[model samples]
Target: MGIRHIDVRLCNGCNICVEDCPLDVLRLDEATKKAYIAYLRDCQSCFLCQSECPQDAIRCVAVHERRMPKAW
Candidate 1:
Protein backbone atom coordinates (compact mmCIF):
# COMPACT_ATOMS: atom_id res chain seq x y z
CA MET A 1 0.00 0.00 0.00
CA GLY A 2 1.17 3.48 -0.82
CA ILE A 3 1.37 6.26 1.70
CA ARG A 4 -0.12 8.87 -0.53
CA HIS A 5 -1.87 8.80 -3.89
CA ILE A 6 -0.83 11.63 -6.19
CA ASP A 7 -3.30 12.79 -8.75
CA VAL A 8 -1.26 13.05 -11.93
CA ARG A 9 -3.94 15.11 -13.61
CA LEU A 10 -3.99 17.68 -10.80
CA CYS A 11 -0.27 17.66 -10.07
CA ASN A 12 1.84 20.34 -11.75
CA GLY A 13 5.21 18.79 -10.83
CA CYS A 14 5.89 21.54 -8.35
CA ASN A 15 7.58 19.15 -5.87
CA ILE A 16 6.08 20.84 -2.86
CA CYS A 17 4.75 17.55 -1.52
CA VAL A 18 8.15 15.97 -1.89
CA GLU A 19 9.79 18.81 -0.05
CA ASP A 20 7.30 18.68 2.79
CA CYS A 21 7.42 14.95 3.43
CA PRO A 22 9.08 14.48 6.82
CA LEU A 23 9.95 10.85 6.16
CA ASP A 24 11.04 11.50 2.58
CA VAL A 25 8.41 9.09 1.40
CA LEU A 26 7.51 11.22 -1.59
CA ARG A 27 9.65 12.23 -4.51
CA LEU A 28 9.30 13.79 -7.93
CA ASP A 29 9.72 11.56 -10.96
CA GLU A 30 12.22 12.92 -13.43
CA ALA A 31 10.69 11.14 -16.39
CA THR A 32 7.08 11.92 -15.56
CA LYS A 33 7.81 15.22 -13.85
CA LYS A 34 5.23 14.26 -11.25
CA ALA A 35 5.23 13.34 -7.59
CA TYR A 36 5.15 9.65 -6.61
CA ILE A 37 5.39 7.48 -3.52
CA ALA A 38 9.02 6.62 -3.07
CA TYR A 39 8.84 4.84 0.30
CA LEU A 40 5.30 4.28 1.38
CA ARG A 41 6.13 2.22 4.44
CA ASP A 42 8.37 4.97 5.73
CA CYS A 43 5.57 7.47 5.79
CA GLN A 44 4.75 8.97 9.20
CA SER A 45 1.11 9.72 8.26
CA CYS A 46 1.61 13.35 9.16
CA PHE A 47 -0.45 14.62 6.21
CA LEU A 48 2.18 17.25 5.47
CA CYS A 49 2.30 16.37 1.80
CA GLN A 50 -1.44 16.76 1.41
CA SER A 51 -1.48 20.05 3.29
CA GLU A 52 1.44 21.57 1.44
CA CYS A 53 0.27 20.57 -2.02
CA PRO A 54 -1.08 23.64 -3.78
CA GLN A 55 -3.00 21.59 -6.30
CA ASP A 56 -4.43 19.27 -3.62
CA ALA A 57 -3.00 16.30 -5.52
CA ILE A 58 -1.94 14.25 -2.50
CA ARG A 59 -4.20 11.80 -0.64
CA CYS A 60 -2.83 9.96 2.38
CA VAL A 61 -5.18 7.30 3.60
CA ALA A 62 -5.14 6.00 7.12
CA VAL A 63 -2.88 3.04 7.74
CA HIS A 64 -5.76 0.86 8.90
CA GLU A 65 -7.73 1.77 5.80
CA ARG A 66 -4.89 0.86 3.50
CA ARG A 67 -5.79 -2.79 3.86
CA MET A 68 -9.06 -2.15 2.08
CA PRO A 69 -9.21 -1.96 -1.68
CA LYS A 70 -9.49 1.69 -2.53
CA ALA A 71 -10.61 3.22 -5.80
CA TRP A 72 -8.24 6.18 -5.62
Candidate 2:
Protein backbone atom coordinates (compact mmCIF):
# COMPACT_ATOMS: atom_id res chain seq x y z
CA MET A 1 0.00 0.00 0.00
CA GLY A 2 1.25 3.47 -0.81
CA ILE A 3 -0.81 6.34 0.62
CA ARG A 4 -4.55 6.76 0.98
CA HIS A 5 -7.29 9.40 1.33
CA ILE A 6 -10.92 8.95 2.22
CA ASP A 7 -13.77 10.81 3.93
CA VAL A 8 -16.34 8.23 4.95
CA ARG A 9 -18.49 10.73 6.77
CA LEU A 10 -18.45 13.04 3.78
CA CYS A 11 -18.55 10.28 1.13
CA ASN A 12 -22.12 9.50 0.12
CA GLY A 13 -21.13 7.06 -2.69
CA CYS A 14 -22.33 9.67 -5.18
CA ASN A 15 -19.65 8.46 -7.66
CA ILE A 16 -18.54 11.99 -8.40
CA CYS A 17 -14.94 10.98 -7.93
CA VAL A 18 -15.37 8.08 -10.31
CA GLU A 19 -16.66 10.47 -12.93
CA ASP A 20 -14.22 13.30 -12.20
CA CYS A 21 -10.92 11.48 -11.75
CA PRO A 22 -8.81 11.51 -14.87
CA LEU A 23 -6.51 8.75 -13.62
CA ASP A 24 -9.23 6.29 -12.77
CA VAL A 25 -7.85 5.69 -9.30
CA LEU A 26 -11.07 5.87 -7.31
CA ARG A 27 -14.03 3.59 -6.87
CA LEU A 28 -17.23 3.13 -4.86
CA ASP A 29 -17.61 0.12 -2.60
CA GLU A 30 -21.10 -1.25 -2.70
CA ALA A 31 -20.64 -3.51 0.34
CA THR A 32 -19.03 -0.92 2.59
CA LYS A 33 -21.07 1.88 1.06
CA LYS A 34 -18.04 4.14 0.76
CA ALA A 35 -15.24 5.24 -1.55
CA TYR A 36 -12.02 3.29 -1.93
CA ILE A 37 -8.66 4.19 -3.34
CA ALA A 38 -8.05 1.32 -5.72
CA TYR A 39 -4.80 2.71 -7.10
CA LEU A 40 -3.33 5.11 -4.63
CA ARG A 41 -0.03 5.12 -6.52
CA ASP A 42 -1.85 6.87 -9.35
CA CYS A 43 -3.04 9.75 -7.21
CA GLN A 44 -1.86 13.17 -8.30
CA SER A 45 -2.71 14.84 -4.99
CA CYS A 46 -4.57 17.55 -6.86
CA PHE A 47 -7.44 17.79 -4.35
CA LEU A 48 -10.01 17.64 -7.13
CA CYS A 49 -12.21 15.14 -5.36
CA GLN A 50 -11.83 16.98 -2.08
CA SER A 51 -12.94 20.17 -3.71
CA GLU A 52 -15.89 18.35 -5.30
CA CYS A 53 -16.97 16.63 -2.12
CA PRO A 54 -20.00 18.42 -0.68
CA GLN A 55 -19.44 16.99 2.81
CA ASP A 56 -15.92 18.43 3.13
CA ALA A 57 -14.65 15.14 4.48
CA ILE A 58 -11.65 14.71 2.17
CA ARG A 59 -8.02 15.49 3.04
CA CYS A 60 -4.57 14.88 1.50
CA VAL A 61 -1.66 13.49 3.50
CA ALA A 62 1.70 11.80 3.00
CA VAL A 63 1.67 8.02 2.87
CA HIS A 64 5.34 6.98 2.70
CA GLU A 65 5.50 7.24 6.49
CA ARG A 66 2.97 6.42 9.15
CA ARG A 67 1.49 8.98 11.51
CA MET A 68 -2.21 8.54 12.28
CA PRO A 69 -4.50 5.81 11.03
CA LYS A 70 -8.19 5.94 10.14
CA ALA A 71 -8.58 9.65 9.51
CA TRP A 72 -10.72 11.48 6.96
Candidate 3:
Protein backbone atom coordinates (compact mmCIF):
# COMPACT_ATOMS: atom_id res chain seq x y z
CA MET A 1 0.00 0.00 0.00
CA GLY A 2 1.07 3.62 -0.52
CA ILE A 3 0.41 6.94 1.12
CA ARG A 4 -2.79 8.14 -0.55
CA HIS A 5 -4.70 9.72 2.30
CA ILE A 6 -5.30 13.44 1.59
CA ASP A 7 -5.48 16.14 4.23
CA VAL A 8 -9.00 17.57 3.98
CA ARG A 9 -8.39 20.79 5.97
CA LEU A 10 -5.45 21.53 3.74
CA CYS A 11 -7.70 21.29 0.69
CA ASN A 12 -9.25 24.51 -0.59
CA GLY A 13 -11.70 23.01 -3.10
CA CYS A 14 -9.81 24.85 -5.83
CA ASN A 15 -10.24 21.84 -8.15
CA ILE A 16 -6.62 22.21 -9.27
CA CYS A 17 -5.75 19.19 -7.18
CA VAL A 18 -8.45 17.18 -8.87
CA GLU A 19 -7.20 18.25 -12.29
CA ASP A 20 -3.61 17.36 -11.51
CA CYS A 21 -4.36 13.90 -10.17
CA PRO A 22 -3.54 11.67 -13.15
CA LEU A 23 -4.81 8.57 -11.36
CA ASP A 24 -8.39 9.86 -11.08
CA VAL A 25 -8.28 9.15 -7.36
CA LEU A 26 -9.31 12.65 -6.24
CA ARG A 27 -12.96 13.63 -6.31
CA LEU A 28 -14.67 16.83 -5.23
CA ASP A 29 -17.02 16.62 -2.26
CA GLU A 30 -19.89 18.59 -3.77
CA ALA A 31 -21.42 18.84 -0.31
CA THR A 32 -18.33 19.94 1.67
CA LYS A 33 -16.80 22.04 -1.08
CA LYS A 34 -13.61 20.01 -0.67
CA ALA A 35 -11.68 17.23 -2.36
CA TYR A 36 -11.77 13.52 -1.50
CA ILE A 37 -9.81 10.62 -2.82
CA ALA A 38 -12.16 7.67 -3.15
CA TYR A 39 -9.83 5.42 -5.04
CA LEU A 40 -6.61 5.72 -3.13
CA ARG A 41 -5.32 2.51 -4.64
CA ASP A 42 -5.20 4.30 -7.97
CA CYS A 43 -2.82 6.99 -6.75
CA GLN A 44 0.60 7.03 -8.38
CA SER A 45 2.54 9.28 -5.99
CA CYS A 46 2.67 12.12 -8.51
CA PHE A 47 2.73 15.43 -6.66
CA LEU A 48 1.22 17.46 -9.48
CA CYS A 49 -1.70 18.77 -7.42
CA GLN A 50 0.65 19.74 -4.59
CA SER A 51 2.71 21.77 -7.03
CA GLU A 52 -0.30 23.60 -8.45
CA CYS A 53 -2.18 24.33 -5.22
CA PRO A 54 -1.91 28.08 -4.53
CA GLN A 55 -3.10 27.72 -0.93
CA ASP A 56 -0.49 25.09 -0.28
CA ALA A 57 -3.28 22.85 0.87
CA ILE A 58 -2.69 19.78 -1.20
CA ARG A 59 -0.03 17.32 -0.07
CA CYS A 60 1.06 13.72 -0.75
CA VAL A 61 2.25 12.00 2.37
CA ALA A 62 3.43 8.47 3.04
CA VAL A 63 0.95 6.49 5.15
CA HIS A 64 3.07 3.98 6.96
CA GLU A 65 1.40 0.76 7.89
CA ARG A 66 1.31 -0.30 11.54
CA ARG A 67 3.80 -3.10 10.98
CA MET A 68 5.90 -1.06 8.58
CA PRO A 69 8.33 1.80 9.10
CA LYS A 70 6.98 5.08 10.42
CA ALA A 71 6.15 7.94 8.06
CA TRP A 72 9.07 10.25 7.46
Prediction-by-prediction clash tally: 0, 0, 0
Task: Itemize residue pairs with steric clashes in candidate 2.
Answer: none
Tell me how candidate 1 scores on lDDT. Answer: 0.80
User: Which sections of candidate 1 miss by over 4 Å?
Assistant: 64-72
Candidate with more favorable, higher lDDT: 1 or 3: 1
TM-score of 1: 0.79
* TM-score of each predicted structure versus truth: 0.79, 0.70, 0.68
Task: Report the C-alpha displacement of residue 56, candidate 3, in angstroms.
Answer: 1.3
**CA-lDDT, candidates in order:** 0.80, 0.72, 0.70
Which residue pairs of candidate 3 clash?
A: none
Estimate, for each residue in 1-72, the C-alpha lDDT of model 1 and write its tens digit.
335588999999998888877778888899989998878877778887887889988887767423555699
The TM-score that candidate 2 achieves is 0.70
Across 1-72, the per-residue lDDT of candidate 2 in tens digits comes to: 232568687688888877787778888898977888888777766678777877666676645433445668
Model 2 alpha-carbon miss at residue 13, Å: 1.1
